[model samples]
Target: MSVKPEPVSALFAGSFALATLSAPDGPQFPALVTPDARVTDLRVALADEALTVRGLLEDWAATLPRLRALAAEDGPRRPLAEFRVHAPVEPRQVFQSGANYRQHVIDLHVAHRAPDDDRPEEERRAEAAEIMDRRAAEDLPYVFIGLPSAITGPYDDVVLPAWAEKPDWELELAAVVGRPAYRVSVEEALEYVAGYTIANDLTDRATVFRRDMPQIGTDWLRSKNAPGFTPLGPWIVPAESIADPGDLRVTLKLNGETMQDESTKDMIFNVARMVSYASRTARLLPGDLVLTGSPAGNGMHWGRLLRDGDVMEGSVTGLGTQRTRCVAEDAS
Candidate 1:
């Protein structure tokens, strides 16, 4: 089987982003990624030989302007296509929003209706909509902690455990925190964001619910925290570049078939609310990710779950696109 690599620039527009990359013969390093697929190693650009994306994020206020200046000037650069891409940042914390998208939650409720449920589809949808409206009006966002170890490179392969009967795709928009935020207000939440990236939060439906201890709630640990479960970023597009994070399109395709394609407008709690809510209890540090939650059109909705050799391609408008092939791991 011959593999032809896709040009990294084709996945994004004419803008600048921060990414982690390595040449076929060199070590991985943070870089200034150009929409034309050229990369300027941040070490050389910043005059810091040991620079990392996390470190850049920690000093994002000072780093961003420098990155911008570098983006506009000529420097020693190599075609990004010649390098291996890695997850842009190795975050210390990951906060995941659950059922935050109105249509997404509604779709799940309707799709997972019990066998005894004989309600008309329209009635079920309407009921779900009402519940969503109530959830929207309510003050809090449903947020959960996720392990950073689960994160993988944007172009890496996802190993689906053989025991995972119903692995699914959930493409989401994740905000990258640049400033330390604690109990921040919704009006000021975006101020703490450095930028945004694409995240594909894969899940194992079979392991989601604990049949014996239903009261304990969804087992997110086993369902979502598997290694390589969260594929994040070819790069992080600066927040200043995106006009409105709330209006971007989140799209995912399976084997070239469009599966999840929804606007952030469908979100019950917007990015600000989600970020503010997350900061209320936990200290959101630099490089921490606040996943805004996945939109509708999961594998469960179409009854076509992930299989070995399936390819998932996802993107958040202007952020960039990520492609990952699925491989079934031997469970035994």
Candidate 2:
């Protein structure tokens, strides 16, 4: 029996915005994709030279269709593999969710409970579940800010600072905001999203807490904002393509071994709810990133802290994959 070849679909049908290095230690340009899956280098792809991916995201609704139409027309095309891909967009503001995954938070609570308090595991789990249920009912989402300077390309090398003894990985799905949102309702939240990308929110586990100030909570700046700490994106998959952001699978492999394997369905607060919660206090502008929390099976849970020469591959269904290699910070 003969099998039929799958029909070739338009490249923009599930389109992504990508950047490529134009020269060694030089400027990057928007990558133009063709209908046949080939990429073309063209200045016309971007109207403004000063506008980075962040600016493009502001007009994503109009920009996407234009690029798609351009791709359908004749143009100089190159093989997609020939170019180096950078993070899809440079976010002006980055909002990271903490303990938003049901299983992940429960795992953390159970693992960190005091040794003397030997409550039954089942009871502890039930209590954690109750807390999540309460939080969902109360409409609360824990969000923290991250610096944009820490952003790096998906395949960039992550330099583990010498002071950081326990570098860890948290793979997450990041929503890219297209419109300015302030106090948006949950029913209208997803409409403000331009697209989605993958971010590996690398953390220094040893520096997560404040040693001097026990009253203060997590020191996110010290723990999560090192240079190149956040390895983001192979591309931005337009939100329209993702029918349900909550149903996607988030997977990570450390040194070729499966580490984190879970679905966004496990999230305590879904994307819409999280976005709505974030906008309640902050003005979410175009190109701002809202990172939904990581799922269960982080490095802390597995006791497999990142080391020099270790590689981590993270992917979200349809969003694309990011592979980052770890290297020790050069003190010289």
In terms of lDDT, model 1 sits at 0.90
How many steric overlaps does candidate 1 have?
Answer: 0
Residues 270-304 of candidate 1 have per-residue lDDT tens digits of 99999999998999999999998999899988889
What is the Cα-based TM-score of model 1?
Answer: 0.95
Locate the minimum summed-lDDT window of 10 residues in model 2.
1-10
lDDT of 2 by residue, 1-332 (tens): 11111223443336444444343455787665543457755455555666566666677778778766765667567765455667777778999999999988888887778879799999998888888888778868889999999998888888899999889999999998999999999999999998888999999989899999968988999999999999887677778878889999999999889999999999988999888989999999998999999999888899889998888888888766678889998767
- Predicted model with the maximum lDDT: 1
Q: List the residue pairs that clash in candidate 2.
A: none
Each model's TM-score, in the order given? 0.95, 0.90
How close to the true structure is residue 18 of candidate 1, measured as C-alpha lDDT?
90
